[model samples]
Target: MSPTGERVAMATDELQATLPPAVTVYERSVYSDGDSTFALVNDADGKRRLYVAGPAIADFDGGTVQGDGQVFPLTYGNAMALAEVFPWLEPTTAGRQSAFGFGDRIGLATPGHVRAVRDSDLVPVFAQQSIREMDRTGRSPEDVLATAIFGVFQEGYEGGFVADADHLMAREDVERTAGVGFTMFTCDPSEHVVADADSMSEEKVEAAFAQIEDSEAILDRYAGETFEAKTDGFTWSDSFSEIELKRAAVKYYEAIEFAEELYGWVAQAVDGDFDFEVSVDETETPTTHLEHALIASELDRRGVEVTSLAPRFVGSLEKGIDYIGDLNEFEADLKGHVAIAETYGPYRLSLHSGSDKFSIYPFFEEYASDYQHVKTAGTSYLEAIRVVAENDPDLYREIHAFALERFDEDKATYHVNTDLSNVPDIDDLTDDEFPKILDQDDGRQLLHITYGSVLSATDENGEFRFKDDLLGTLREYEDDHYAFLEEHLGHHVDLLTGEIED
Candidate 1:
């Protein structure tokens, strides 16, 4: 922020005098050069234009420049770039508060999400996608944020939205996503979570801990030590056996180290303010009550300030389905988890596989004031598939067949239990009845997990088999798809906000 010149700041009268007589100045920002400012003005005909008010004016000359300082296009694609120049246009973290992350897997679900979110108190994370998904869909984080910017402009939504670099797992990906203008990073540490660490024997846990170079350092810090942490209403004071301490450390120490590395990198890598969401919800076993406190307390001790934490709750929160576990048990576990979070920091209690888990929304509503973040990505994609099934039978049938063919392979990474036999055979149904497959839980789960394979599937000829056709068909029936998303996603929002009718 060095001074480019000795030019004095303009007064309001001087600024008005410099503008066109008939134009209205909406915004003005000091250019990278301190002597000049750029104004976002509306012309007499109501078209938005960028007006440069400066003495140094050789570069612009009413044409686009190719170098560092260029005239931005009026296209929606430039919204993100414009936001960079004007900080007001950029969205920041919504803080440790109640928020909903509506991830649009196809990049077409934002407008519907916007419609659903505009009426509620919950903040909208309209541009939410994981690094895994970006790889799956051949998209970069920039594409995800750009698409959301356009969606916001289309619907005249200026309330602002989150550009979440969701489920990020590596250090290099952290630099890449932050450079692409994401305001939130969900660091997923599931890769380092040992399978069934809660059930490991003391010998096994010690052996696992023996692999760490400084295992003794961790043991000296927490082993045989009583942890006494409290909030106004809750307190957790417990001592762990050396084995129990090593077990928690073994399960999460590597993950926490990775998170620490990524957090420090991203905090300095990006230009603006951002938030961190730590996710340990990808492990095999359910996250134990003590495990939740262990991770959070250790994170605090390591100087990592978490913005949100996703626990592996007691349930099968499978894809495109309701919570498949005891609600009472979930509520009990959730209350304890929330208490742990409160005792440490009032960070968000984030739900990871939170799409269409209708039965659990009541819990979110119950703890609305306590701050919760529920993430949903595949449900919108599911609804879009529903649209395709109803609009174009042939394409839907082709995808159905393709999904079944790729189900087992694609489902390897996800936590779903869709028995292929449970899905009704398409051959047994008429074209008119095939779309109803979306209603069946098994069928929805089958299609849900196979999206990556289906999207990237190509034939022997080395060309896209169904990707182009699917997008084209979806585009043709975009309105139907949007309406469908609104009804489906709106109900989800309603369940969380208590706006649902009988």
Candidate 2:
């Protein structure tokens, strides 16, 4: 029941005076919900807790009451309860806007992400994590989503955000994130995408196509058919021959079928509306024009409402670095992909591994400005590590050296091409120069893919080797961390929104 009163809230300074001596209240976080005033506070121990003050203290359950109200630990349950009081605390959909997924591996980066996104027109998916990331960081889907909610609360950001269950490959993955209230589900069907179809002979392609369910129906529908689409500034037209149709079918039939299945599972898992994104960008081969059109067509035909689709563009979109390929070719390829999205479903064209690709931002904005979603994961973490290198050189040295040792083993899951020999020896550098390694491509990627090892590393006693120190440093110097992310990620938003200076 909503409290009936003139909604009362204590001033930040007043609230801080009433709380414990060491407890500091977040100024922005102080707000009135019903008759009770709620704020997120950090104690001297660096633990964040929820502080509620008002006569309706009993209505706000949990925690010990000090002067006027209770101080509750920022647990998942508390966050959920707070979200009930304020609907804005929950994640929402980005809809048809150009969204950006800022994947926070450590969960402390969303406030910085929020600061960057708030100044731009793009929608923000603040809570995004893959099953692989969850496994590596030992974070539950609940952990990821809750941390994002907490961060959003601490920053007092009322702007809507999307919670993405990113790169989900199985029904369980979708169910898990959906159960935790994710608003978007990205279906990754790369494993099912047959890359060999691109190089197969006509006979081999035909044989492979015969194995597809409803192969005759697919052939009758798309074979020898002319497809055309009009994009923002370009027209795309393509006619598929029987051989080409078979090749496309053999390549993406399974992936499309899997996407359809995943879509159904997502719909069933969620109680209400949820956005769905199909991602085939992680495969070995780039998605061709025909393949993209065919995949979109098939998913649409299967009644899957794809909100966005990440087609593998014609370039090397490697992790934690700039785009690697010819600009002209990429632009030309992107035009067709954008056209396919417009023609089939008008869904956003998502770019996975999208961060730090400063060179391609202009092209994306030019062609798919109104229908694009740029996702960035490791770059934010890299920015945090930069904070460490600048503040605690010894810790940065330890992490960099540990990353070098774990690079080969951890690199198995990623598609990076960083040569360790190219990385500068950190020992030779002065303490002040430690942050420069984050600037070089090889050095950036060397630390990017090995985040799991670095974060999860434990000592002989099973205590965290670097996680505590890393987190503590970031929290203690959050202003600096937020500034770095704001400037760095803000540049990305600026470029994508055409806010860049000449």
Which ten-residue region of model 2 has the weakest summed lDDT? Answer: 1-10
Tell me the whole-model lDDT of each prediction, alpha carbons only: 0.75, 0.87
lDDT of 2 at 232: 64
lDDT of 2 by residue, 31-128 (tens): 78556888888876887778887754554556786657788876777778778777887889987788998999997898899889887789889999
Q: What does candidate 2 score in Cα RMSD to the true structure?
A: 2.2
Give the per-residue lDDT digits (tens) of candidate 1, residues 109-216.
776788878788887898899888988977777778766765654454556777788988777888887886788998887777776667888888878889988798
Off by over 4 Å in 2: 1-10, 55-62
Off by over 4 Å in 1: 1-77, 81-89, 224-238
**What TM-score quantifies how close candidate 2 is to the native fold?**
0.96
Give TM-scores for every candidate, taking all chains together and pairing residue i with residue i: 0.82, 0.96
Q: Candidate 1, overall lDDT?
A: 0.75
